[model samples]
Target: MKIEVTHPEPKPGEPVGAQYWRSLDEYADRPEFKEWMHREFPQGASELDGVNRRHFLKIMAASFAVAGVGLTGCRRPESYILPFSKQPEGSIPGLPVYFSSSMPDGWDNLPLVVETHQHRPTHLEGNPLYQPYGSGLTAQASASVLDLYDPDRMTSSYRGTRRITSAQVRDLLQETADKFAPTRGQGLRFW
Candidate 1:
């Protein structure tokens, strides 16, 4: 059904105030305007003429089942855990071991308990058994173990522009020790 619409014209002497009319359709007050107001959406927007919701859902479910079956062979391979054939003397996989140690500071020593995991020193704490030094570690002593794994630390000795082996460095140290032995470490300065 078609409805006719007409636009209202204001008189020459009257002014078109702000509250005169909201919209042209409302001012015209046609049957088509009332039908448009009663609808939830515009024409052809809410119309599902071809495939209804039930058929659409069944097609989606079948597509999902086929896709799932095709992806079954694409799963990750299974991984197995194996135990070590022969374990090392004092190394364990997860547990840490603690050993009593001392940190030398000038004339005295600070008692410490060194914690090691897989034979590698991981942490250091104060020894409570030693009464002379209280059960608290100095900041310097606590952080000293971390220097063992520092990335920038020198891994090998160097003499001038040439790389030196451990044996060469040991020989040079023995020579220094022999020279200082006569003086009883008098002239040998340690920083």
Candidate 2:
């Protein structure tokens, strides 16, 4: 058997050759040609004939499995919508609403205002009715909201050795006052 190769070039004033080989090197050096040869006649591993097909199929199957897993994982969680029992007169759901209130912390009772969205207080602003201490809500008032929400506040207000209610605290104050009332003229030391 014998094999021959040919090269062709376009002539002057003629349409350029759409496809032609310039040299045997051009055909042999092509990446697609090399890849096709590798797929058709792989060297040094005859067992790869069966393994390569199985490997290509396994890779494609795994790619589809990963794509399906990713799509199923992207599903969003379910959300529940609960309306307020008594919605405020001017408040609307999904809209920012402001309310005028006073922060009774002796630091300018400016109309402490807060912005609420969907019945949740999302932000706080200083009441302009009081003195303007620069811009938005003061650090103390902002921190007070965190303090109010803290679980430790109730635990910190207990009397030594005993947990007493507000009424019990008032009675204890009255008893201490009665004991001190009789000795008003005496110079007593607090220590």
Candidate 3:
């Protein structure tokens, strides 16, 4: 349905001036405008005097926790699970497992908990078990998922301008080891 809005024309001998509207509702008196006028906060921005920012955050957190509790009861759909004669020590076929792990951050290894689906690591969280530091995963830990699937990650070893396979690299290392065998204690390179 199209609603036509017509503005009042100036009286016979009056000079024309700019027309100002307080709001779209004031100009058209729409049903939407009536609804807005009836609300506690007419323009939708409520004055927070009795209810402040802290109280608002608490309410929001409580609501989210309640919703999460409700969702936890739901069951997943049927899927395939490979039967192993002897399953690996920590793995449970259907349930997601959490592993306490860490990543290098300067001098310290930042504590993290990895979430695994089946046998593959899916995401990272904070590890609460370690006594040295309390559990809290950094934003960088969460973003490590991108590195797992990075296309530019080094796949092959290279020597100078020559491309080499793992087998060739192993052979070259063996040759160097043979060359250094006779002088094991006499001379060594470090740094």
Best by lDDT: 1
TM-score of 1: 0.44
Count of backbone collisions within predicted model 3: 0
Cα RMSD for candidate 1? 15.8
How far in Å is the alpha carbon of 84 misplaced in model 2? 3.6
User: Could you tell me which 10 consecutive residues in candidate 1 have the lowest summed lDDT?
Assistant: 40-49
Two-way lDDT contest, 2 vs 3, winner:
3
Clashes of 2: 2
Candidate 3 or 1, higher lDDT? 1
Each model's RMSD to truth, in Å? 15.8, 19.1, 18.1
> Where in model 2 is the C-alpha error above 4 Å?
1-77, 106-110, 131-137, 151-191
lDDT per residue as tens, model 1, 1-191:
89989767988878777767668997998889888878858886776679788998999999999999989678788899776788877767899988998888676788999999867999999999997767788899899999999999888999887889999999988999999998888987643
Candidate models: Cα lDDT each: 0.86, 0.70, 0.79
Where in model 1 is the C-alpha error above 4 Å? 1-86, 158-163, 172-191
Tens digits of per-residue lDDT, candidate 2, 1-191, equal 78787656667788764768766756668887676567665554555554687798898999999998899678688999887788768887777988776576664454578777765665678866655554367677776656655786776346787788888888977877777889973654332
Worst 10 residues of 2 by lDDT: 41-50
Per-candidate TM-scores read: 0.44, 0.35, 0.38
